[model samples]
Target: MSAKRMQLFAFFISVTLIWGCQLEEQEFIPDVSGIEAEVDIRRFDQALFQLDTNDMQPELQKLMEAYPELSTLYFTHILRANDPRTAPDGPAPYVKGFLQHESVRNLYDSVQVHYPNMSDIEAELEQAFRFFQYYFPDEPVPNVSTLISEYAIAAFVYGENDLGISLDYFLGQDYPYQKLNPRDPAFSAYLTRTFNREHLTSKAIQTLINGLVPPARQQRLLDLMVNNGKKLYILDKLLPYAPDSIKLEVTGPQAEWLEDNELEMWAFLIKEDLMYETDNRKIRKLVDYSPHSPGMPEEAPGRTANWVGWQIIRAYMEKHPETTMQELIALEDAQGLLDASRYKPGR
Candidate 1:
């Protein structure tokens, strides 16, 4: 071939590669400007902490009035305190005791400093729920409320219309979670690394998604993967602007590792005959949160199988563009979905 022709060929290949990458990165973000969804964020933490200790009873009454269901959940479930209305000593003693605790007070103060204003979070959620409405127009958007759960819980969805976010759980990676409670296994470094503002919105949306998606009935590894993958897919649609690392609840390096080893990971799964493995203990190692996927390299993030399942779902959706989100979710045959995906990793 002529030198000029060779140069043109190389340039064309580069342009095609770049265009393909740009196309891959392109997300189909629907126009949510017309969606009439709004996030009603209540500062429950601020209100409860600012209550007057001197006149605690009426103050508690006012709080209960302001947040009837949430207040009850706070007392009974979150704090594990006696119900204020039915307790022998009433709400004052519990309120005063909680306020007077040195550790709890300090935690609340840290939460305030870290989250001085939740306007940014509120706006992000507003956009997410707008997308939610765009996808599930019949479903009602939940009211959001913030609290200081003292590391007890990160986020919770109450019934169909209320979502609570625990501010203390998201106090960033430098909050010394282990130092605060070394005995608690849940405060491990691998998990707490995600305890930051960047993960707040994604975590909240994940909680909501969990409530919306049906629980997996089959106990096999593939069923769990597809079930969790469906949830992740829905979450991706909801938080279209969130980073994949945040949605996957992994560090940047971990996310990179998953992307680089996609084919290897899938091969490992198939070679080991783990796809149909129904042992709960065996399945948990691959799908559950941990330092790394057991039996895989240290670089392989926990929930590695879940990420693969996500790719399968992505492949299926790409191959069958006519399948709607609702339809994809409604189709429960994991094996059939995998077969239809024709999911060749490098392709």
Candidate 2:
């Protein structure tokens, strides 16, 4: 080839590479710096765990005195968590007992060993907070605190101005306790799937959003499904950086199965006329966290109804692109959404 022809080919390759780079850059994650909040995170776990057994009482006293925020957290969350018999004024003995518990000590050691550096999660929280600020500017960004929960009923509990993360709940999926008691009925599949550092921020955001959306109770199967779908859809927008597995609150295989069998699953539900059914047993099979979805293939994951609902909501949004998030949240008619969605899978 001539020199001129070679130069032209090289120019074409450079232009293609530049375009590819720009496209990759456009894939968006929440911009933390863009969020306008000076929200400070309090590491309650670190402070508590750092206490010396030799001077336990004095160390705790000094720690609380130094960080008043932690004092408030202990009185409000840790004390009550250790024992419901606790009161704000009389928490010293309870705190001492809580620290002395073998399980509590073990959890602390695991956390220290497993999650010595939370800088990445700290950054993730900032990004999530930024998204919260962007969507709801008027809402106060809650002060975040990380503490051990001693296996409390709630993992990520929150109030108007404070969000508490139970560090024990998010110790990796293969945490010794979870593995030892794999068949423990109390430990739901969803809880086990999302128990990791990667899900910490996403779960926090979900807890926050749950407060805004009053749950659907005793509603028809379809309504409950759509309500869940709406929540998940909101999450997709809010936590764009989260892996789909985290957002869906499922493992990768489960999500892939749902996607691959979308049409067949929808058909099964429709043919069986399960949408309008109000049978708790039937609805629970499709909606709740379990080993697998009942009445479907044994390989199908639980919450197939939720996956279908998510698809319907996505279809509705795409068809009606003019709808705002506020409008979507306010929508109560699940049947209307389905009708509007024209959701015919395999099309």
Candidate 3:
């Protein structure tokens, strides 16, 4: 009824609205636009399977002749010999069996059918590599080599100057050979979400980043979370064109749930004081990749702690505008980052 009371009411309402808007507002990290570097990803899988050879010896010799440099890696690493002692003696006796196996042929055929021309994926790799070179000029851009493997466990394997993609691993989720029928949670997670073509480039880039910036020391849970967060943040920067789901490696609903409960998740971590706890079980459950994060509600996605840590790093970057990507990568002090972040959620 009073003039001052009405003014106070309007001011409070405006404050509430502004605060709510701030909570909902996501900081837009820009994509690396118009990167010109052309990365010609070498197709090791194609070269390996080009010949329909019942005679393994000649084909093996031809492969060695074709890719002299990569042949060593292919034999030693990819198609590992049953006996390594006699290995560069060329095709071990069992090599014939490996080459002629129906499963092996099927896997090779699937990859060939799925990825006839990797030009688009190559361009995506080139763009990500360009950003990497842009940020860290001293580092070398690795030569990409795509191949198929029996295990398909390590989807993207990296070395100092070479990157390898396991093609069979990316042959869509429902690929009959995926072993999803075993009903294992871990296998299900891999097949349902990660085992897809879209994830290849992102995984490759992340692997490169990981090699450059080794995992932070895991003395405390906070350290692990921050390190994981750093990786995700770098991934976000490198693959800016990638959707949040792909970058975060979460489903659509999972991403949405995390975004909605970001503030609540932060509060839960603080209240529980799990950030600095040294218990491996608790830390793994929170930080490691799983179907869902342990100790949180069923609605929460896996790695909620890492998500919170990413937000903290994002907040810290916001507060300290001078912090470069390289500096962020090199940053080892989890506590310092958390303090600098001044990350008060739902404010």
Query: Going through the candidates in order, what is the number of backbone clashes in each?
Result: 0, 0, 0
Weakest 10 consecutive residues, lDDT, candidate 3?
Answer: 4-13
Per-residue lDDT tens digits for candidate 1, residues 112-147, read 999888888988999998998888776779899999
Q: Candidate 3 — which residues are off by over 4 angstroms?
A: 1-35, 51-62, 65-69, 85-92, 157-159, 177-186, 189-191
Whichever of 1 and 3 has more lDDT, that candidate is 1
**How close is every model to the real structure, measured as TM-score?**
0.88, 0.79, 0.84
Please estimate how well model 3 matches the true structure, expressed as its whole-model Cα lDDT: 0.73
Of the two candidates 1 and 2, the one with more favorable TM-score, higher being better, is 1
lDDT of 3 by residue, 59-94 (tens): 777877866666777676666663456555545455
lDDT ranking, best first:
1, 3, 2
Question: Top TM-score: which candidate number?
Answer: 1
Cα lDDT, model 3, residue 334 = 85
- Give the 10-residue window scoring lowest on summed lDDT in candidate 2: 19-28
Q: Score candidate 1 by TM-score against the native.
A: 0.88
